[model samples]
Target: MTSPILRDPGNSGFVVELEKFSGPLDLLLHLIKEDEVDITDLPIAKIAVQFLSVINELGLNQAADYLEMAARLLRIKAQMLLPRRLGDDEWEDPRAELVRRLLEYQQIRELVEWLGHAADARAERFGRGYEAPPPDAPPAPLQIDLNDLLAAAERVIALMPDPNLHHRVVPRPLDVEGATARILALLAERETFGWRDAVGGGPQATLVDVLSTFIALLELAKRSVLTLSQPEPFGPMVITRGISREAA
Candidate 1:
């Protein structure tokens, strides 16, 4: 059976061909933009229905990611629909979690785009080509893959100690340049630095700080300025300076 995804094409019933995506988050970004909805302020119920409807074309095997996202949306919608008692000022907004995930995914998408563009630019320019002498011994195998570096970052972040941040509005977002410099500085002072130490802390060190610092480390690792290593399974990741100036 064929399925048609509602594109919100001026009518809820108007169907459009389902386009392929890398994952459910990619599809969610498309829907959010198509519906002219704000990421920070999602229309949870409406988007929830729309998302589920759109994924009907994907079949169960290909639809797991979308299904998971849809569940989150419905759960958020359900909590929002439940009547709040009068003077219930302490309840947290259920939408916050979804919004945070959306923002984080968007950031990763942008970073990947930039890396792609940089790759293309490097390909276009001519470089000084010279013949190198034969290696004295067999060449060394590549120590790390950039994707694995990112995974290492993921592991570190997943294992991070929750600062149990107090609820407050962030006045300004974390600075990437500042965070990058701090991490580099920490590495310079010592041969290696802990993930938490590289991330730093204070009233200003929000989760955003940790995320930004991670991305900064990713960029550094991309430039071969830093490396990440784990001595044992689930041990603390060590961030150290890389001797080689090469991209993996």
Candidate 2:
């Protein structure tokens, strides 16, 4: 049996300079947009028709990435077309899986768009015409306190039991402007949130982001620009500001 592939390159407008089509799912998303099919209620029959038509146009030498999704789509279409027996509890629509996959892709796309906007804003802010003020009239550097560093260091050190374990503990780099802003924003809206609650649960990236946020807050407190209070010194700290900088 011939392997499925999306062959036609006609107006697949995903021709924009992406590094490469990552996989079949990537190709499916492109085809959906190219064919102007709704993501939620994907017309499997119509999509499958357009999909195979494109494959026929491409002939051989088609990229495996597009081929994979094409195969998956064909399978889904087959399953959807299969007649259901009476009183079958396992009868489920194949389009449901495709919709879920599309929803996830949409989420990633939205995040990518947001990041692009942020990058553009940063570029404009730091562009060629950006000149620093004279040294005498320079903006004051943010204040940093010694005690705050000690406290943060102490918290980190406590994670390790043996003094020898200190070397095993990597010193995390101190740069969390975004995370710091998020924490401050959350605190501003709601007076208190447990440190863990603010951090949330996820992969290592999220954990490290939260750790960086705590460090940022401590750094701010050292400058006397913010204050932290723990009703119980060992308990969760309640973060508040000394300076009137916009929350977050």
User: Across residues 18-101, which tens digit of lDDT does each residue of candidate 1 receive?
Assistant: 457667788888899899988998998778777777676454223456657777887899899988888889988999988898
Residue 236, model 1: lDDT of 60
User: RMSD of candidate 2 to the true fold?
Assistant: 22.1
Q: Pick the candidate with the highest TM-score.
A: 1
True lDDT of residue 179, candidate 1: 88
Badly placed stretches (over 4 Å) of model 2 are 1-23, 34-36, 55-61, 127-248
The 10-residue segment with the lowest total lDDT in model 1: 1-10
lDDT of 1: 0.76
Could you give the C-alpha RMSD of every candidate to the true structure, in order shown? 29.3, 22.1
